[model samples]
Target chain A: MRIGIYGFGSIGRLVAREAVKRGWEIVGAIDIDEKIIGKDIGEILGFEEKYGVVVSRDVEELIDADVVVHATSSYLDKVYDQILSLVRLGIDTVSTCETLSYPYYRYPVLARKLNEEALRYGVTVLGTGINPGFLLDTLPIVLTAPFNIVEKIVAKRSLDASKRRKSFVEKIGIGMDPEEYMKALREGKLTGHVGYAESVYLIADAAGIHLDKVEERQEPIIADKDMIIGEFKVRKGEVIGIKGYGTGYKNRKEIIRLEFHAYLGAKEYEEIMVIGTDYEVRWRSTGTPGDQGTVAVVLNIANIINDLSPGLLLMTDIIPFKPFFKH
Target chain B: MRIGIYGFGSIGRLVAREAVKRGWEIVGAIDIDEKIIGKDIGEILGFEEKYGVVVSRDVEELIDADVVVHATSSYLDKVYDQILSLVRLGIDTVSTCETLSYPYYRYPVLARKLNEEALRYGVTVLGTGINPGFLLDTLPIVLTAPFNIVEKIVAKRSLDASKRRKSFVEKIGIGMDPEEYMKALREGKLTGHVGYAESVYLIADAAGIHLDKVEERQEPIIADKDMIIGEFKVRKGEVIGIKGYGTGYKNRKEIIRLEFHAYLGAKEYEEIMVIGTDYEVRWRSTGTPGDQGTVAVVLNIANIINDLSPGLLLMTDIIPFKPFFKH
Candidate 1:
């Protein structure tokens, strides 16, 4: 299979490396960055070996590729043109964009347009990863199939931001004081996280429930002692982390609760509880890494794109995600 | 769809009732019980109306039925001849037998023969229920599809036996003295709940891991206080319940742990934890009634049976179970 890569960043490079390991041909790569525009794909990714495929700023170069693995940005609005260009060129795509995970819930207009364009060009497009795609939302909906009825659902995911990317720490306002953190949060410079609300909406939609209201809240986790994380230092009596929650309401009752917490040294785990009529179910996993989980999910579902019908599809529409075991 | 019910017991009656409500035709009913023979199905089930169907002692009466819903027995060995007769007659079957959930693990020869007969007659046979089929095993295996690599799996289910069947109370030896309960357990009068071992085997197979050893252990849950359930009374310090666990090991490392606890007034819930290379996943459900859950699953997967290939199949081999929402 010939593959092109969009968003030549850490996740994109990981996808390329995995594809190469599977003996898939790296047809081309597209990135808007100027510094590595003409560099060899392997060299741009810091590998000593070269694959002879140069990075190009043009999407046309990737028209010959069978599928494109996209990890460019977080939202569908941001990557709309880039994805539309590839879909028009008749290329299948698997992306890690969080909002695109279930765009039909929040961005129906754009999602419909993308679906129609993909159908016209006879291509398939999917948005998936670990967080919004699996941990808090899609997994819970699928787990409720055994029950006669489900009344409520609560899903919680906690992360230790110290072990995560630098961007995560900055986004959470880790090193800032309470006043500064509050100021950034109000100004929208620091939003809690991208996928909590999306996860809530995805669950509500997948379970066929209509929520009258969807709400979000954020708070700070105060630091008790000094801490140090790769080049970043945190002082005592400051904002050490952030906790965010998104809830969906129906008939004045909160039916879905999605809680996410990321702190300097917080416990790392994910938990989902589904309250059903015949059964109430809960699932939890400890010590799951963020990057590895998302990247692995993206690469695992890449090959499944072409088999799917053209549309802005959620994880539910495709074959359930399976482990990519190499024989 | 022309449906024939074999067993004419509580579960079989439930399946027939559900199928009737869905507008399916009840072609015939089969049972060896003398008391229910020659009785109209509706009259036997205490319904005001008759459906013009009568119970018969011969399996041959069900040859014209499109499918058979079997729920008369628990062990595959006890139901082997009954199931083989249906397969030879070229009728598809869905049963609630625990051992048939994953018969290949403990009954390889019988499983192979059933598969061969099913293939020759172009019919499909499946065993499923709330315990071995869903809460403990199949749900966890299906939930793990989003991971890249899984290292270990742990599933636990606890039931409030007081709210369950009278058969469950007897099976767990509730209200019995420790000595008497042990004697019954040892004499095969009351074996531990039948599905924990099957659950472990199913998960191991679905994960593509070969377990070197699979073991089960059971102990009595002694009553701490006097309790009254239905007509059974439990005294303090007496046997009130049973706890059973099945574990699978590979190269001396415990890989799969399935624990089940059932007692009078025990806290009821189900939990599953999957520890993978990139993520650890957990799911739990509380207050699930066993009979209701099993009936719901059977009805939900009924349409999928005719679409599957002719063979002895697992829940994982078919389209994952989905809710049967009426439009």
Candidate 2:
């Protein structure tokens, strides 16, 4: 399959490398930066040029490819117009964009617009990645396989986010004034991603439960003392980490627990648990260095686009309980 | 202590009888029903007159007591002003009124106003009962005792409503059209108890977690066959039960799950579970006929009023996990 990758930054470049290794053809790469455009994709990631495909600034120039892989940053509010453009061109698309995964939960009107556009174009659109997509959607479904009678489902993904990008660190209010961090949180400006509620909604849909309410909550950085990160000294009242949690309840009973935590320079772990009438199942996995799990999820799904059903799908709709690739 | 029982209904009469048995002085009883005014409290509950306390429709006259126990029905919106009036009169009060437990969660502005009035009057105001107040508040704290490291807390209270009052049966949508029930649920009009969110919030506060988000959800009643009760025949599409759930998440992690379920003519059961680092503790209690558990909680707390700290308190704030009265 000839694929075009939009946003040829870190994750996008990694996806390109993985796709090449899997024998998929890279038609071209699209990036917003003019300097990066027309450059060999391998050269951007410090690899010797092998595939002759050059990065293009023009999105329309890459529309002829069989699939468009969107590995853009978390600034998804701006990407909707581009995705809609692709939909208008009748191009099949898959995104690792955080907000688009479950747009309806956060950006309801935009999500609806995207869904309608995708349907109108008759092309499938999918949003999948580590946190919102996999933990919320895929993990819950995997945990429920053994239980014919599921009483509740709780999934938690905790990350030592110090190794993450600077954007992530700032978004979670790490190494910032606690009061300011809290103010941003209350205003919803600091919500790093928007799919926590969407994930709960997707799981409830899969579980055959019609929920009357859905709620999301966050835990701000409550640091005992301040420390320095990247040359800036944070004070005692400053935040060094933050946690976000979303839950779905059945009949005023908690049926699903979706939690996400990111800490500056800490150990990372992910767990998914389901409570049922007969038994309970839990899956815990450690994240690789530098948020490699995020890269792995994107690549894993990229390799199986053919096997997946057409249309917009969440992570739970695609991820398998067992690891996708055997060592 | 001189105490007046307001709203001489089932719960109020039960409180009066229990108080009489404990040798506590019953100042009087009050109800909205004019027909019941001036009647002996004993005659209201089919018992012989012994306390010489008469039931009256005059709420103002009843507020003269040192304490007034408000055990009114669910129409708290109508009585909130009256309750506030009594609180302003400097009466130390305990209420089983459904909406009083967490006025902040349900009616925030009113709860705050009442709180201010109670503080200004130097009087204590408390709301307590079996389900929303005790099961959600006291039970969670009790379950957390064994675990030094609590990762999450989940509480579930399920009751078979066959033995419930006629008002409860109608409110829960038992023997009602399912479509209409669902419509009411969507409109938020069918929310039977608004205190579920308050219960979760109170528990979260006790746990010392600053919750970023709290969400509530409900489930529709689904039955494969029609249910017949008395002269009312509920179709399969009609709701026979309802479930309400509230969850509090800290740092995007699931920390507390509070749930309540009511069914018409149903068996009663309550369970509290605390998931901690070292161990998980679960307590399940079954009720005898006529919601004896509800009476137990009220009577237990009343017996220890002298031992309690001098202030307003919820069921959890006053009642110890141990037996109220040793056998």
Candidate 3:
């Protein structure tokens, strides 16, 4: 299979390496960054061996590829035109866009438009990643299959912001005081975090719960002691991170609750607890690299893109992803 | 939807209740038991409300129903004629037969024949339950979606036979001495317990692992102290239950391991652990009622029977089941 790597950033590079491992030809890379444009893709991703593939700013170069592994942006609006162009060119796509995870609930018009375009071009478009797609929604829903009656779902994801990329740390309002964080929130610079509400909404939809209300609350994780993370130092009492919760309610009872925390000293682990009529299930993982998981889900979904029907699809709408390396 | 029920045993009655709850009409039931032949199913199942349905001995009585929930026997051969009759009558079926979970691996001819019959009649036939279908294979495969490279999978299901029905306890050779159990095994009255090897093969198939050899070993779980389970009693050094392991290997390396134990004092829990290149994950359920889980999975699959294509299908071949209750 010939594949294109869109948005040659961290996740894009990850997908490219996986594609190569699958013996797929990396036809081209699309990125607008001037510094990396025209550079050997392997070198840009810190590989000493040259792959003979260079990053290109021209999207037209990807037209010949069978599919594109898109890791461009979390917001569907930003990458809408690019995704449409790929579908129109008859290239299937598997993206890591958060909003596209279940866009119909939040972006009905865009979701419908994408589905129509995908059907028109006879291609499949999917949005998937570790968080919005897997960890919080699809995984938990799948876990509950063995139980007869599932009454409630609770999922918690805790990540140490200091261990994450600088962009991710800043995005979560780390190192920001109450006033500064509020300013960013009001200015719309710090918009919706990826998985909080999406997870709750998707779970509600899957369990057939007509959620009467969805609620979100965010609070700062204040530093109790001085901490230093790669030349970024924070004094005691300063905000080191953020903790957010999203809950979906049915008939005034909270049926889906998601807790997320990313902080300098956050205990790093992920867990999901499900309460059923006959049994309760819990899933946990420690030392799971966030970036690797996000990239892995995208690559896994890419392998099955052709097996799905044409449309804007959610992770649950497709067949469950199997291990890609089926040997 | 009008539904006919076959087997009219524990799982059959369970499916009837679920179907009724879904507002499906119980048109008729087919069972060989003379005692319940003309009895109202609701009364036999301990319900005060009359369902206006009676059990019949004739398989022809099931022709008018939209589907049949068959839970008669564990072995596919024992239930083959019955299943074929249902398919010939143009009634779709969801069965609890273990070998039927992935019959192609062990019964190629029968599997093909069933598929042809199902197609000829434009109906679908599926075998699914908590054990062979969900907990051991599909659940673990679905859990590995976030990992890029999965090296191994280990699942452990420990059940306390004392907590289960008498039929389940006797099926596991509980309270049987070595000589008695061996005689039963040789007589074919005590066949292999369901789900262990079938789970391994299904997981191997779903993960794309071609096993060079699949191994199974069963040993006695002896009672160290006197234990009483209802009216059944076991003395010290007597066989309390059974412990079985099914392992699938590729290139002489173990890729899937399933350990099952059902003994008097066994700790009750279900867990699946996966070793991935980046990280490992664990899923656990405490005090999970096996009977309840089995009944739930069958009912869940029944809801989606028409959503799938016509065939003698394995659990992995169809879409993963979802929570079916819409209210």
Candidate 4:
């Protein structure tokens, strides 16, 4: 199958390389980054050979591709036009947009428009990734297939921030003081993880459960003593990393919760606890790499996007088992 | 939704009770037991209140139910006529029949005919339960959504035989002589577990992986010393329980494996290991009750069976995700 990569960011590059590794043809690539716009896709992906597919800034270059893997942004509103253009081109596209995983929770208006636009053009547009699409949300829903009645759900992902990419560490404010980190977070300077409530809503909606309120928050993790992590050093009583949480409530009682932790020296693991009537299933895994996990989810999704109905869809629409549906 | 229970045995009764508790109407029930054929389902379920729905051997009484939950047998061939009758009546149905979960592997001709019949009548027919339907097969496939390329999968379910019902203990040939257990198993007096290859085929089919060969085996687990377990006494070297395995291979390399253990004093848990290109994920959970698990799976499927397209659908076709597909 011919494929296209639209973001050319770290995730996009990884997807292009993996798609090629899977023996699929890379038809074209689109990126706004001038540094690599005219370069061969092979060189950009650090391959020994050139793929002969050059990175272009024009979305039209991907017109002939069967599917385009969009890894540009996290919010549906921000990438609304980018996805809209791809839909009009009649290309099946799966994205890494966090909010798009459950757009109605945050962008009901835009979601309606996209759904209509995609149906008109007869193309499928999907948003999925590791956390919002799988681990913290979709996995929980799938794990609950054996449950009689789900009462509460808690899904968690904890990663070592020091081991992540430099950009990720900087985004979470690894070297900032506690007060400074809080100030920056409040001022939108140091944004922590996104898509907590997206995960919560996705799981809740898949289970046919309702929540009156959904909330998300992030805070800095303070260090006790000086330590060196990666290329950075931490002082006593300073910020080490970030911890974030999302919770869903109904009638003033919590029904779903999601936890994301990325800190130096953090134990890496993913846990999903599903508490149902007369049974509780707790599934814990040795954590997966976020960057590679996205590539896997996207590529795996690309293989089946053509089979899906044309519309703005989420991971729930494509998974092959019967999810809870109230008839 | 109005429901019908076919084969008001243990699983069927449990489903009836759970459905009533969920506020769904138990319109009718069918069972072959002459003693309870004319009895009220509520009383048979030990509920003080009468539901006014009587258990009858005639399938015609359940023609009005929106859906029927069939728990008669494990083999699809044995229940083919029963399921086909429900389809002909224009009612959706979900069954706990083990091989029916992936009938193409065992009864290809019946599967095709059933699919056509269900489609002709505009009703969905499904086969699902805890073992073949969820843990060993569907759960493993769901857990691999985050992986890029799944190279191998291993799923295991271990339960305590002593905690299960007397019939289950007898089915596994617990407290029998080792040689007698083997003879009984060979003579078909004791059938340890059904649906190993069915689970293998279901998971393999979902993951879009091809296995050239599939094999299954069961053996008795012997006791080392004198012991007492659940109203039974065991001598040294006697049978305590059973262990079974199913394996799928591609080019003689194992790609999928399933393990089932129901032994006295066994640690109860479920584990699924997904080994992919560059990552491996292991999800272990506290054990779920088998009888109740079947009830949960059937009820959950009952809630969504109407949403599914009319066909002899397995768990794979109705699940709500883009299971791997090769374009």
For this target, which candidate reaches the highest DockQ against the unseen true structure?
Answer: 4
Docking class of 2: incorrect
Local distance difference test values of all predictions, in order: 0.78, 0.64, 0.79, 0.86
The model with the greater DockQ, 2 or 3, is 3
Candidate 4 Cα outliers beyond 4 Å, as residue runs: A320-327, B320-327
Order of models, best DockQ first: 4, 3, 1, 2
For each of the candidates, give the backbone clash count: 15, 32, 0, 12
Candidate 3, B39: how far from true, in Å? 0.7
Report the lDDT tens digits of candidate 2 across residue range A1-327: 677888888778877775665467888788888888788877877776556878888888777678888877554577887777777877778787777776666677877777777777787777766655655576456434333345777777667655667666777877767778778878867865456787887787655467768888777766666666544466777677777777876677777778877775555655666564534545444432323445445544554454445566665444222111001
**Which digits, one per residue and each the tens of the lDDT, describe model 2 over residues B1-327?**
567777788778777765565456888787878888888877777775545778777666766576777877654576687677666666767777666766665677777777777767777777766655566676565434323246787887777776677666666777667778778867866765556777787776555556789898876566667777544566777677888898988778877888877765445655666664434545454432333434434544443343333444555444222111001
Which portions of model 3 miss their true places by more than 4 Å? A228-232, A319-327, B228-232, B319-327
Give lDDT tens digits, candidate 1, residues A124-242.
88887888777777777656655545678788889988888876788888888999889898997887677777888777765556778999889889878887865668888788889
Better of 3 and 4 by DockQ: 4
Q: Output the lDDT of residue B195, model 2.
A: 66
**Model 3 CAPRI rating:** acceptable
Q: Lowest summed lDDT over 10 consecutive residues: which window, candidate 4 chain B?
A: B318-327
Give the proportion of true interface contacts each model preserves, from 0 to 1: 0.34, 0.00, 0.48, 0.64
Candidate ordering by TM-score (highest first) = 4, 3, 1, 2
List, residue by residue over B208-297, the lDDT tens digit for candidate 3. 666889888777778788878756689987888888889988877888899888888688888888787657877676645777777767
TM-score of each: 0.74, 0.47, 0.94, 0.97
Docking quality tier of candidate 1? incorrect
Q: Which stretches of candidate 2 lie over 4 Å from their true place?
A: A73-77, A186-189, A226-234, A288-291, A306-309, A316-327, B1-327
TM-score of chain B of each: 0.93, 0.84, 0.93, 0.96
